[model samples]
Target: MVRESLKILLTSCFLLLFLASCTLGGGKNGKLLKSTGQPYEVVLEGDTDSIVTKILTEEVPALPQPEPLCRLIQVKKGKIHGSYLLVRTRIVVNIPAAEFSVGLSRNENASPQTVIRISARSPQQLREKLNPEKLRQLVDEAELEHLASIISTNPSKQNREMQQLVKKNFGISMNIPAEMQASKKAKNFIWISNNASSGMKNLILMKMKEVKSEKRAEEVNSEERRVKKTDAFSAQEKQQIDSMLRTNMPGETDSMYMVIPVLAKRGLWEMKGDAMGGPYVMQRIRRGKTGDEIIIIGFVYAPEMKKKILIKQLEAAISTIK
Candidate 1:
């Protein structure tokens, strides 16, 4: 069954590539590509109860907290096209009638385009034969590719000076836009934001001393253990974030402050006394052997703007951590 599925997927991808190449004009094909639609917005083209839909929309509870997979990615479901035949396009998922086939295709039309094709003889067959965990992983992998492609198509010049500043101050190396400047800086915290009239894209970096324990040190750092540690640390991180935001990230008024919702790894934040808010995602990673941990927070503050794309841009920029 797996072999058959692979065959179908490969053939479809090849056919789409051929058709796209034949149809597109030369200069237009090589033109600077700009990512369209909101970030993490998926063009789902499948039955409402299809396995692909079910897996992509599943609630992910394994994090230090629980949130829907779509929420974590800030995925907004686009208009349904309901056809797998439209593979010669950008980030799209096509669900065809076949027997368990799934594959990702690139360069189908534009320079940095992607198409995820999933098929099965029936939805029931797909559910029976598929591993939900693997399917969830596939979505995440595709999301990274989609993000990278967007950045590639719309390249941002590296702000070397800002990079140096961050390294000197925060002891971290990551890419930031040349125009983005640090609005706030502290011994262990920095807030960098881009100057966009429509909306603001911001990134916060906070480093703290990880508490040392004999049991924690002795625990094998496997993937499972790492997840457990993150789950435990998530609460602590949230408290720290709340305190930081209250002190550093002041709102329009003194009464307004940022608060992390209970048992949430991501949520919308609103200024208490002001009518301003947007989405946010927080993640924690162990930095070094010196018992230091890094807490990365990316947020959006576009009152009347769609935030998924900007939040995604912030995520992509931060992902450049080497």
Candidate 2:
């Protein structure tokens, strides 16, 4: 009896140490192992029904422009990998057996240690409990979180000269990538670009005079302006923006100019004289009533490359305007 008890105790102690090692052995450089899915993509594990699939993959129409909230949010079917197993910012949906829950956890294995998890009993329950709008919002939040991580890694990678120019002229500080160079700096305007051999990414910052209206503009005491209106996605605003681009963005000669083909969404620009074109996002930001309004434009001129990532990068940079 004594021998048997001793044997059991030894086995239990060994098992505890083994489990602890397994839990702790997986990280490097204080970062979780890199996740498996591509950037903006999620690997979904478990059985999904038509409703769940539609909810996960459907394009979000509510955005100023209709585009798949999940277009960049690619999803694949598989069990959650060990790398992203503990990631706190995750969307995890189990089958009929589990209950709904949302909480945080530390994934010792992924680059992002925190994970956001969503748990539900089943696809039907998930759909029944969450509306389409909420679903889209969750996905948007996740993507923004991922984008923020990218920005945090290199917050000051932008050119110092352009930074100074923007601060001096616009009184705004921008977070730009070091890969970009200051291309144009005019009165109350600044343009920066990464003029790579094959493709180019551009950022434009311009200040607009606010006309006095019935509602006096609120005075903002901040050094930088805040993005006030998100109405640029409207057709009328797009037309106005198109007009602005035609007048402000010049081509090499008088006959050549940039034009927006579609005013419904982020407009596409093409040089009349040249074969250059890409996608662009434009926004008008304000600093309450007393401060001037500013227009920030982020565009990509990558003809042969994928514009989604580049455009997203521009969007991320422009979003930094405080």
Candidate 3:
């Protein structure tokens, strides 16, 4: 009986030590593991059919068609213990609490990770506190930063020659992808394109004289100056942009030119005499208080492919402009 008791005690002690080592070792390994997930992907921890999920998965506005801002991988809260903790981006919602709160943390379990936690006492409070636009903006910003980081780190993937040409011509630097080449260059305009057979990805850089009207000046300097969609531009501004595009982005024939239609959704660009068209993202930045304004436009012409990701990649590349 004494020997049996001693044997049992030893077994229990061994099991305890083994479990303790596993706990410690697992934590350390998790920290060492690099974050994993596709770009623009977020692991959402909540009921798949909950309001939180629906709000998060809503289509992003201003696109040609319906497209979610972030690719969501929904998982229940109880199942988010192991590999899910290592996702590059995560959103945890519907957490029960006495008071509502939202918090964000980075690199908690793996390098380059973002975890957002939202807690509320009831669904109504959650709905009130959760702003779909703001949530989409937050995720979009994070994804852009991640993509920019990847592009900046991989110098070999960048088009050094085209980047140098841009810097020389426009006095600005951009991380043009290696696949793209300079298709056209002028005094104040430069066009870069991959010219792929499947589809074309193009970037246009142009310098424009700033409109000096007081109200226009204020709007230009205001935070609202950041162009989010084609609808943000006034009729006059759209006319001016169309004129510029006609002079710069021309097609094969004399009558063919690019124009942003008055009723275009999400900055859609159409070729006047050609059937080719796609989504475009444009941003205008004033170089200095009295310097020429810079307009960067990234557009895709992939009729045979899904364009959201292609446009996203171009957007990421454009975000690297300095």
Alpha-carbon TM-score of each model against the true structure = 0.64, 0.70, 0.81
Is 1 or 2 the stronger prediction by TM-score? Answer: 2
The TM-score leader among the candidates is: 3
Q: What is the C-alpha lDDT profile of model 2 across 1-322, one tens digit per residue?
A: 9999999999999998766655632545343345445545654444355454466567543122334445323234455555456443455455564687655455545545444455677766777675666655665565655665565566566567776777888777667777887477666666788878666888877776555444434435433444456343445445555566666677988777777675432566677777878778766666674457677777788666666666767777666665
lDDT of 1 by residue, 85-195 (tens): 222232333333646776777654444445666666665776776677876666555565566444444546666777787788767777776657646787688888886
Candidate order by decreasing lDDT:
3, 2, 1
The regions of model 2 sitting more than 4 angstroms off are 1-37, 50-53, 59-81, 84-89, 97-116, 216-244, 260-276
The alpha-carbon lDDT assigned to residue 67 of candidate 2 equals 43
lDDT of 3 by residue, 1-322 (tens): 9999999999999999776654411464432457789887889987543776676678765566787667778887767877777788889876577898878887776767887888887777788887767777777787777877777889888999999988997777889888896478876888899998776889988876655577667655667435322224555556666777889888999799997774332478889999988898876666444446667888888887767777878888888887
**TM-score of the candidate numbered 2?**
0.70
Ranking by TM-score: 3, 2, 1
| Most lDDT-accurate candidate | 3
Show where candidate 1 strays beyond 4 Å: 1-98, 108-110, 127-140, 149-156, 195-197, 219-231, 234-237, 263-265, 272-275
lDDT of each: 0.60, 0.61, 0.76
